[model samples]
Each structure stands twice: as C-alpha cells, then as structure tokens.
Target: MAAVAPARRRKRRSVPIGRMLLLGFFLVFVLWPLYWMFNTSIKPSDDYLTVPPVWFPTEPTLVHYKAALFAYRGLDGLINSLIISLSATVLSALLGTLMAYSLARYNTGGQHLSFWVLSQRFLPPIGIVLPVFLIYRGVGLYDTHIGLIIAYTVFT
Candidate 1:
C-alpha cells in the first residue's frame, strides 16, 4: 500500500494587539463613570471631597440609601412614579387599540386619516409642552396624579 501524504495544518489568524488595546481603552472609558458612581455611593461622606479620589471605600455604609428612602421621602416619590406610569400605559394601550380597530374595520375618516394620526407621534414634545401646561393649569389639574397620567398617555 502507498504511504499516505502528511495532512496539512491550517494557520489560525490572530487579532492585532493595537486594535485590542484601543477597544480595551474605550471599554474602560465608558465604564469608569458607572464604577465611580457606585464607589462614591458606598464611600463615607468624608471621602467624597478628598483631593485624591478614593478608588475603594475602607468602610462602606448604607446611610445615604436610608436617608434617601426615609428622610427625603424617596419612597413616596417612587410609589407615585409607579402609579403614574402604570395608569398611563394601561390607558394608552386601551385607547390605541380601540382607535386602531376602528380605523381598520370602518376606515374611519379615509385613508389619509391614519397617516395624519401617526404623524402626531413625530411632533416634538417641546412644541406642545407650553400648550398642555396651560390647559392643565386652566382646568385645575396641575400637579395632580390624574393630570400626569393623562399627559403621559396623550404624549405616548
């Protein structure tokens, strides 16, 4: 029998060291701020304003968290945010479904009407802010939960 020829090995391509170094530098630059924020939160107040920044806290404390949730009423604000967001989401979904169904089944207002309605979404919030604020104020809904829910639902 004839001797089999030796099998050839494939050469694997290697990544450039310079490109890897550049990507690593960008990764650190983007993540450094997030790391600093977390580090600062856990650090003692005295270490916050030190000339040389504290990379690691010797004694981590939860006093800031406790103060935010209790003393500053952060818990109440969180609850209010949840309520407003949920209410607005539900209302918007319900109204949008009804409108879409009507448009599809009945072709309410003609073919262009759907386009007109969708165009409203592209309008900048800044343009309507003053008008909505004025209307809310005039209707005595300013600073109320219901008003915020309505505003969010409409904008969304």
Candidate 2:
C-alpha cells in the first residue's frame, strides 16, 4: 500500500451548557423580580395576605392606583418628585460636563481628584444613610422637596 487519505469532520455548532445556564441565570435574576412586582401591583388587596403566595394574580384591579392618584393626592407628589429629580439631573449633568472638561484640559486638582471622586462609588450607601438623615433633619432639610433635590444632586 502507498498511502491513505483521512476523512474530515464538521463542527457541531451548538451552544455550550455553561453558556445556556449563565443566560438562564441572568434572565431569572433580572426579570423575575420585575415580573413579580408588576403582577403584585395589579392584584387585589386580599392577594397580599393570601396563603401560598399567588404567583400569577387571579383578579387584577387598578383601584389602588386610582385611589393613590386621586384620593391620596399621589399626583401632586409625583409632579413634585419629577420637578425635583429633573432639576437635580440637569444640574448634575451640566456641572459634571464642565468639571470633566476642565479636568481634561487644565488637569484641575491634579491627578488625585479623579481618583477621589471615583472612590466615592466604592463607599457603601447604607453606611452614610443615617448620617445624611441626621444632618438633613438638623438642617431642616428633612421631609422637604428641596431636600430631595439636594440629596439627589449630591449622589449624582
């Protein structure tokens, strides 16, 4: 015999089990809570205390939303919240843009400033909540719309 030719094989072209598992994990973790919250929000008041915990609501109603929006004056609260949040967001965006431009062009505050600002993200929100609450109370900022705007701006 002179020589023999080997046969070639095609790839399976299939997704790995690990990748599917990871995707499934993300889907469940991210979407399940949101689904449950919306489902619960539309459910009847009795659904809350029901035994076995209704996964899918049997009876859904918008009475709670209507009551809150009209009877409890939630619309006014919503409007106030929107104004405060929008103002804070706009202020932060403008200030952040200016600061970043200055830092990039003039190297303002030297190199350490960037690191210090970045380090704020690492601090736990829970750790500062009590202090912030106390300070807001002492300064008469607590339970005020302006307080919300200030608090949101600081975090931004």
Candidate 3:
C-alpha cells in the first residue's frame, strides 16, 4: 500500500489595516462611556465637576455605593423591580402558553388572528401610552406594583 501524503494547511487571511483601525475606533467609542461610568462611580463627588475631568480618581471610595444601597432606598427599589419583573414574566408565560395551545389545537380565530396578535408586538408602545394611562387611571391601577406588572405583561 502507498503511504498517504500529508494534507496541505490553508493559509489564514489577515485583516486589513484600515478595517482594524476602524474596529479599534468603534471599540474605544463604545467602551469609553462604560469606563467613564465606572470611574465616576468610584470617584468622590468633589471630583465629578472638575473642569479638566478626573480620568482616574486618586482616592477612590465606595461612599456612593453605600449611600445608594442604604440611605437612598436603592435596595427597596431593586426588590420592587425584581418583584414586578418576575410577576409579569410568569403571568405573560402562562397566558401566552394557553393562547398558543388554543391556537394550535382548536385553530380558534383561524390563521389571521394569530398573525394579528403577533403584529401587536411590532406596534410601538408610545402610540398606546396615552390610552393605557387613561385606562389605568380610570381603573385606579395607577402608581401600584400590580399596575406595573399588568403593563409589563401586556407590553411584553
């Protein structure tokens, strides 16, 4: 039997210099805001409005974090957010599953109804904001956790 020849390896293509530069520029542009946010968060309040801006804080502190999580009720806000999100998600999932099952099994409202329901997702929230607000006010669901959950469930 003849010995098998080794397979030739393919050469890797190199990225163009101009493309690399453009990618680097966009990377810096996107990451600069994140870096600034983190830097500012750790910096003292006095350093915030400096004319030249502080790129790196000489003395970083966790005072802001402490205040937000404790004094400013940030923890409560976070808990409320979690509650609202979980409730809305569970409700939406349950309702969506039931609707989908009915549509699949019974073909209720025919094909057009499913399409129409899906098309609602593409509708901009801004368009219905006024109507929703009025309805919520009328029903006295305004400024409540249940209200938020209901709104999120419907929108989502």
**Candidate 1 lDDT, 1-156, residue by residue in tens:** 999999999999899999999999999999999999888998999999998887899999999999999999999999999999999999999999999899989957978999999999899999989999999999999999999999999889
| Model 1 segments more than 4 A misplaced | 1-13
Give the Å shift of residue 98 in candidate 1. 3.1
Model 2 C-alpha lDDT per residue in residues 61-151, reported as the tens digit of each score: 9988999899999999899978998999998899889888887889678789989988998988888999999999999999998888888
lDDT for each of the candidates? 0.94, 0.89, 0.95
In the order shown, the candidates' Cα RMSDs to the true structure are 3.9, 6.6, 2.8
Pairs with backbone N, CA or C atoms under 3 Å apart (clashes), candidate 2: none
lDDT of 3 by residue, 1-156 (tens): 999999999999999999999999999999999999999999999999998988899999999999999999999999999999999999999999999899888968867999999999898999999999999999999999999999999998
Where does model 2 exceed 4 Å of error? Answer: 1-66
So what's the TM-score on candidate 3? 0.78
RMSD of 2: 6.6
lDDT of 3: 0.95
Which stretches in model 3 have alpha-carbon errors above 4 Å?
2-6, 109-112, 115-135
Lowest-lDDT window of 10 residues in candidate 1?
A: 102-111
